[model samples]
Target: MNAWNEKYLQVSLLWFAESARNKADPSVVTKDDQEAYLRQARFAQGFIREEEPDPPMARTYSYQQPHALPKVQRAFDRTYATRGTQREPAAEPFATATQSKHMDHGQPTQTTSPLAPQGRSSGQIQVTGQWDKTPIKLSFDPDASGEAFYQTFFQWAVKRKRGADLDRERTTLWLKASKATPDTQAYDLELKEDELEELWNTAVEWIQENKNTKAPHLYATVEMEAG
Candidate 1:
């Protein structure tokens, strides 16, 4: 009953009508035929006439184990503080004294705040506030009420500190309403594919980095609800 299935049904019906009208051929598709009926239909009808749409995507929830994420490599060199330049034992007693060149250990720079996330970590995370300006805001359609559900979820996130948790880069959150059809934010939610992909990808990458960091009992989620 996903959106893609509905589309396939439509295409099959179309092909059946066309074939019957033209008396192209008589055929029956049995369960054991084990052929892709939709593909056959498309091939017969010339698929270019009607492009296939992306199907209703299934996004399931997940909880990530506490872990570390790889830090973003900075283009510019970063400097860090070192405890009193403890000189290593001289190669030779008469070796000329020389300062040690800092070796890159991929550590954060000295100026980096301790709490500043180098990667996803465990424990309560501190966060700041900010507004996310939609690139092109869409006017709310009261009749559909699809968008309203999304707004409600956003508000819930703010109230429940989901937004804060996400900001801290310590959690991944995906808000998807379970649907038998490809709603694409049509009835219970509202979002374009690009936006959805961005959200989904961001959460996925967050989960990946957290796993790499290997924090403890870390939280990663793909939350679904009956909208």
Candidate 2:
């Protein structure tokens, strides 16, 4: 049995004892009274309190020490590259000839790399380096806005070439986006070592821009296992 069931049994026994003691007349207590008391005790013993499970502990897991990625094994790979820019086409043929303001400033904008295709299979890229050694979990508020918030975050991450692994069929991005209710849409994000800082910054920025004014109580937590 679970710890909660054990606790309920103990509480029921105590309540039964107290109820019996509080009876007005000890001599008046009869067989029916005893049976009713026992039944009540049994019912109470069967009761289970409903409560949320404790959030998982968070801490950083360092895989930086030295690790090997064997041949045919999958490893994490990240390549930082400049994201290209797009130019708007001219509205009319001769409109821009005489205008002092010029478009397409001849500068290549620098941005994070675009996300790779989502449906493509992760090939046999090996994970050569170690990752965070400990597990991490995070929770978020649940609501319609929360659902949209996580979806945006996932799309942002996926678009940034950060969502895929050679060993896994599909990268798991956000854990519980669909279940975010107005009251309780807590979600979890598990991260490896290098992703910790990036994830935290993204979450902070998201909260500030999206829910700061009306839902200031909306919050997120970053957790890592205790070492």
Candidate 3:
């Protein structure tokens, strides 16, 4: 089972032993039960104690290494040439000009790129990506507001069975895209919660129309925010 369940079991057993000892006369205490309780207690304490000495070989391990990542070509195909700039006179498929203004999360400021779309439209897209090397997928209507989309993602992530392992405050969602490459350079762009609606709509539009056969699929990454 999981670590939590194992710890809980140990704790429960320890409590049972302690209660039995307190309620029963000293002469009635079983040696086995007392030993079990002491073992459980020690295990529980191990979870909190951090002053334990390091292994003899700890200092010998190398601590520095270059981070390596794949290099992707920077090109936009079948997607809009501009993002968040063109307003559709129809049912408002794109974020308004005002909305796009607040969405500055480290993207190149160029006005022409398939990473941006011409107008808004009604459709749905599938988002597939990684979280700590684990694949994850989610789908939602492209018509939804950026805020709504982010909320849906946030809820899905934090409600997972082992969600406690995620540190929400230091976690952020990013969309992977191509940029000038050293191969080691990061391509993921953060999706800020406040500007998410505008940013998401722009991304969704581009992904829906992207026609480059070799273009990377529009994927997301649940990243631990770097200090």
Best by TM-score: 3
Better of 1 and 2 by TM-score: 2
Q: Candidate 2: misplaced stretches above 4 Å?
A: 24-29, 41-227
Q: Look at candidate 2 and tell me the lDDT of residue 57.
A: 60
Who wins the lDDT comparison?
3
Encode model 3's per-residue lDDT on 1-227: one tens digit a residue: 45775777776777775767786474576777778777876766664444336634455767887553433212232124334335445435445665676776777676754664534322445667678756666665657777666666666666654366555446666554332223343333345655554466566655556512343344566767665
Candidate 2 versus truth, CA RMSD in Å, comes to 48.1
Predictions in order: lDDT: 0.38, 0.42, 0.57
* TM-score, every prediction: 0.15, 0.16, 0.33
lDDT of 2 by residue, 1-227 (tens): 57867786787667666766787874455686679777866675445323435544679897775664653233332211111112324544457575535746676656699787764233211111112332222234332243343444345335544334211112223322222323244434444434433465665444444442322233333233543
For each of the candidates, give the backbone clash count.
12, 16, 4
C-alpha lDDT of residue 132 in model 3:
73
Instruction: Name the regions of candidate 1 deviating beyond 4 angstroms.
Output: 1-143, 166-227
Candidate 1: Cα lDDT at 92 = 36
Better of 2 and 3 by TM-score: 3
RMSD of each: 49.6, 48.1, 45.3
